[model samples]
Target: MSLARRASAEFAGTALLVAAVVGSGIAAARLSPGDVGLQLLENAFATALALGALILMFGPVSGAHLNPVVSAADWWLGRRAGAGLTVRELAAYAAAQVAGAVTGTVLADLMYGLPAVSWSHTDRIGGNLWLAEVVATAGLVVLVFALARSNRATATPAAVGAYIGAAYWFTSSTSFANPAVTIGRAFTDTFAGIAPASVPGFVAAQLVGGVLAVAALAAWYPQAGRSADAVVVPHLTEETALR
Candidate 1:
């Protein structure tokens, strides 16, 4: 895929991801504030599943890396060969992801009439939250690299979805797997966000998780280094044909 096309795919994918997150958070806030935790769990699981399927579907046409962290991690690990994302592409995608999350949150706010990511999620700090972030992000990155490298999960997108869903309950932070998504969700001011003050901790945990994921993949899936392409095929009408 050309650079332009890849960037476009990343933008659209990230937008969709944000929309799913914010939209679901708003709905949960109004329907069952008490169950917001479960709601986020479900939303994130579904989003990851949807994202994985979408990536598989679009991987051939575009790289389908909706998250800058994914793209950067893949490139750094030598998974992206001919089509690694450049600095400009990463920056653009990150901007789009953040904007998309904020936009989705605003729209949800309008519909739910709850303040966007307000006091409900404020001061929501604890070791569980941090540990959850670490585990969730680690699982997510591990899944991405695993399926892409092993070719087991690439043919079917269910693995990513399943991993995400399970991670939500198993991990704490309702599985805020992606940094971009985490940052974007914060804008919502809903139950899904980590307060601005808490953003740093979350990001640090996520990055560490991502790095650990890469290390784990490198150790467990050595072939990942020479993989044809880092493809996270989404379940779509059009499937990616491997080289």
Candidate 2:
């Protein structure tokens, strides 16, 4: 795919993810204010399900990164192929994701009367919040690497989605799997934003998680080192065999 096409896919996928998160937050706010915990649970489940489906739907066309962190992870894995994105591509994709997420939050706020800041439980700040981000992102990266390395995984996308969905529920941080999404959600002051003060910690945690996942993958698949590059994201080309 051309750069424009890839960017477009990233934009669309990010839009869908943000829409789901914002929409779920709105629904949760209205459906069970007293059961806030349950509301979060529902949101996480929905987010995971949506993410998995989207990856399956878009992975073939544009690799379905939808997150700057994922793109970075792919680069680190040495999977940038002839189609690897440049800094410009990364910036554009990240910008689109943040923009789409902000739009979704604004729309949800208008429709559901979500508080601009205090009322929206969307803020993602605090030590606990940072921990959550780390764990959630770790699971995401680990899963992607594992699936990309194996023939069985490459043959099907459902497992990828299933793993993500499960991790959201299992992880302490309801899984803000995308850094761009996390930053964009912060702007809404809704149930999604991690406190800006806490953003750095969360991001740091995520980076650590990513590194650990990469290390683990390296140990499991010795052949992966054959490529000189560090990151090894999945790629598409007619000439290359699936395995």
Candidate 3:
């Protein structure tokens, strides 16, 4: 697909993803009432399932990265090999992701009869949460790039979704591992929202984690590295060929 087409896919995929997250969060909060744990369960389960479905829907067109870190990692790995995303493509992907996230949040809030563009006041900043962001993002990058390196791209949708679901419980930050997603979450004041002030720390931690994951992949799974096309599942990838 052309860059424009791929970017559109990225935008659409991310919009729906944030909708799943924020919408489910609002619904869970309403239905579960004071039970935070149950709300989380409902939100995580819905997000995971929707995420898997989105990846399967868009993986062929854009790799369904829907996350800047994944795009950056893929570009970095494939830069020298000539199959990675161009600098222009990377910028487009990032911009689209952030915009899509905000749109999704707005749509979700509208669905719940809230203002379309309300800013969240939910405080999610702290040392432990920062650490959790690092851990969560690091694991996510490793899992994604590692799969790409090993040519196991097709398995990524289910595996990545499952990991995110588990990370919601295991990590202190509820695993806002994607910068775009983090930004989107800051737009709503609800069960799944995060304060704008906390976004910088979370984004920084995620970027650091992504860098570490890239370095780790270079060292430990060097053989898994491939051309830019190998970064994720594309339309004519090995996974599709196998099927």
Candidate 4:
């Protein structure tokens, strides 16, 4: 597949993901104002379902990595093996994801009759939350790549969605594992918002988690980590196969 097509898929997928997340948060907050736990559950369910659906729809076109860290991790593995995305493609993917995320937040806000853009006020600043972000991100990265290494690509959407849904309750930070989604969340002051000031820490923690997961994968699956044909991304058409 062409790089442009792949990037487009990433853009669309990420946009839809943020829209679901922000939109669902707004709806949940409005519907269950008195019940924080209920709000979280509703948001988590919507986001988890939407994320799986988006991945299933876009995976065959772009690998459905709606997160920038995921793109970076894939590139990190592919570079040494010369089998995955090149540096330029990685940059393109990251940019598209960020733009899509922002767009999705704006769309969600518009749908809810709010400002197109606004800085979030929900403060998620704390070592505990930071640590939770790290754990959440690391778990996500490990789960994703582990499935790929195990040649269980077809199981990714359901597995990933289920993981995210559970992580919302299991983690203190509500598991904002995706940096692009974090950035998008910063655009709203609703239930899902995370203040912009808190974004850097969350992003840094996520990067650390992704890097650590990749390292672990390399150590555990030495052969799969190095094999060009071992990649189990959803979209690996004949054109994508390294000759």
lDDT of each prediction vs. the true structure? 0.63, 0.63, 0.87, 0.85
User: In terms of lDDT, which candidate is stronger, 2 or 3?
Assistant: 3
Tens-place lDDT per residue, model 2, 155-203, is 3356555655666677667676666776656655655556665556666
Our tally of clashes for model 4 stands at 0
Runs of candidate 3 with Cα error greater than 4 angstroms are 236-243
Q: Write the per-residue lDDT of candidate 3 for residues 149-169, one digit (tens) a residue.
A: 777878988899999999999
Question: TM-scores of all models?
Answer: 0.79, 0.78, 0.94, 0.94
Candidate 4, 1-243: lDDT as tens digits = 788888998999999999999999999999999999999999999999998899889887888889988878777876776666678888988999999999999999999999999999999999999888888988887777778877787888899999999999999999999899999999999999999999999999899888887887778765444432233255763455554
Worst 10 residues of 4 by lDDT: 223-232
RMSD in order of candidates? 4.2, 4.3, 2.9, 1.9
Candidate 2 wrong stretches, greater than 4 Å = 79-92, 110-128, 154-157, 224-243
lDDT of 4: 0.85
Quote the positional error of residue 2 for candidate 4 in Å.
1.3
Model 1 over residues 1-243: C-alpha lDDT tens digits? Answer: 445565566666666666766677666666666776667655665566666666665566555666556666666665354334446655765666566556655555666776654522565468878878878777777777777676664543577667766776777566777777666666656656667777778778878877887788878986664442454543221123333
The per-prediction tally of clashing pairs is 14, 24, 3, 0
In model 4, pairs of residues that clash are none
